[model samples]
Target: MGLPWYRVHTVVLNDPGRLLSVHIMHTALVAGWAGSMALYELAVFDPSDPVLDPMWRQGMFVIPFMTRLGITNSWGGWSITGGTITNPGIWSYEGVAGAHIVFSGLCFLAAIWHWVYWDLEIFCDERTGKPSLDLPKIFGIHLFLSGVACFGFGAFHVTGLYGPGIWVSDPYGLTGRVQSVNPAWGVEGFDPFVPGGIASHHIAAGTLGILAGLFHLSVRPPQRLYKGLRMGNIETVLSSSIAAVFFAAFVVAGTMWYGSATTPIELFGPTRYQWDQGYFQQEIYRRVGAGLAENQSLSEAWSKIPEKLAFYDYIGNNPAKGGLFRAGSMDNGDGIAVGWLGHPIFRDKEGRELFVRRMPTFFETFPVVLVDGDGIVRADVPFRRAESKYSVE
Candidate 1:
């Protein structure tokens, strides 16, 4: 009679135990929904059949980047291609879909277990009579899991350090640039190859994350920290939320623009370009097209693609283009063009130079180092001495 649903909601909201139960139920529901959808995808996916765009395949309930195989006709839409199963440590589309199914099952079981013990007062403090979720410890668990995942991907995956041809597409080759990790500081130079550099970054980050998690789980926060952060207050939660958003934003930017993430060319295509407002893959496709037209073979096309040349030009200081700084080339306005720091200038068999690519370090952005033949490091200066006009002793 007297607004029964509102009364029921009030009752549920008031009880902390009930609230936890609701959370579990919510997780279960979401997991079940996602799992069912993923199951459908797995069931319908066929290696032999043509892979359509996810929007066309699943209509409104499309998974954004689910991997697919076979000839694709997306009708001008971007096609998401799966990794090769033959490639070592690469997870195929079907494999990931299966993993989703397993995860759903585990979530369902967890929900059921929580439901059976609905009256358990785990997340509440007996003395305070308030929700006492050990936030640091919980966060530690998440960090540990994330760290393991990142480390695993970096150490073993096809797009990581071990993946021979999949790491990067540079002037040297698809293989990563292996710089010495000796001295820990600046011994030789800091030239991180794509994919490999990305992999190493992940590995290092993962290690730090794991250690931080362990520290958090083991140690108790000081009273000063609690006071400083205004813990147990609504303001703290709001601040944390804002901080989380900014952190996520920075991470996304770094991963996409700076190549910090494990997302590989094979998985998500090349890095987005500012020229197209980061809308679609244009440059890579164009290069591939030109390569294919010239060579008339898919393998040769990929091999001949000079995407790195465009990359060099974008970064500035390319001598081949007669730019200001000579980061890659050894010549200082001289006709004799030489490569910098042993980084090779890739050329086709027809004597046409493809690219003289040299990945710049933080300091290397300004031309300070003098190199001998074959781009050997001979000497270096402190200040900016890039051009031949600014010759110094």
Candidate 2:
């Protein structure tokens, strides 16, 4: 809605006489959020504060429903290595990029909601008497700076950064080179534009951004927390709360469901938006329905499945054809371990399990075509790895 309003009608929408009200409101909201985030990043890195936990302060998110920290890995996995991004913008098992997008959308909505109730005169009008600080000057500067950073910094990262293995998604599956969070520095095969290493800079920026947000609000004098309550606020809050819950369930339940049942599709996101969990979930159901034939057992039909081997090469390696297999230690031959079947389970021909990987993708979460040693015929194995490293058992 924000993008549409701005994009489709920027001239008219931003016209001082037209949608000036909306522009001011949305701008303020964006300003507050973006400014706070930048400020939080700064404070989190304060050398004076003795809390030496460099990145995400583990166990800080004590919400009972929350699991672990909101931190995610360079790629999709339990641990965070390549660039340790913490508090990661939002919460979810769907990984970083997806979470980031969701938060962006959420903040957009919150900003929109702010304008629906209050007039644009002040950040907080309910405060007793005129406070020491001036509203126009403070919010005015904050609004400008925040807008600049959100767009400028955001563009710098998206356009200039994003190295190989930095991990992003696609309509079909995952694709990226192994790289770092810093700008343009990584393993030889990865993207030069994307630098790899400890994302301490990000940590500092994020922590300070949070602090700035709190401070900005704190400086807004005082108002009852619910001062802005209105019919629109209630309706919007209720609607958003419902949507948030549903989205959470979709990402979480979908990951567990798909990761367990079908071949796990490794997703690398700039944020949580990178996870293709929804696409694969629907595809799994569609394939399961089509695979079930009259008088044919599901198990029998499983092995007799079709292979959708799309590509035949990687940036670095040759293809693997025929029944021959290359042993890639624990990765089962994937270049950068993150293909189908996240969990590992070894098996020979037939249904018996030989050795099971701790977090096999063929778990109850997804539909499985159990491949023994002779399995993986479904792989574009000729390519560096299977469709997703998670696909292997």
Candidate 2 local lDDT, 1-393, one digit each (tens): 356542454433212223434555455565455444433333332222111121211111111111112223222222322333444433323333344445666656654565464334443235653212243234435544554454443334423353222232233333322233342223521422222222333333444554565566566533554355332232343465579779967866654433321111222111122222233334443554566745565554344432211111121112111124434221123323222222234444455554321122122233334443433433112223354543443
Number of clashes found in candidate 2: 74
Instruction: Tell how far residue 237 is off in model 1, in angstroms.
Output: 4.8
Give the local distance difference test score of model 2.
Answer: 0.34
Report clash pairs, candidate 1.
none
Candidate 1 per-residue lDDT over residues 135-197, each given as its tens digit:
566667867888888766555553423433232333322222212221112322234323345
Give the range of the ten consecutive residues with the poorest summed lDDT in model 2. 308-317
Best by TM-score: 1
lDDT scores of the candidates, listed in order: 0.45, 0.34
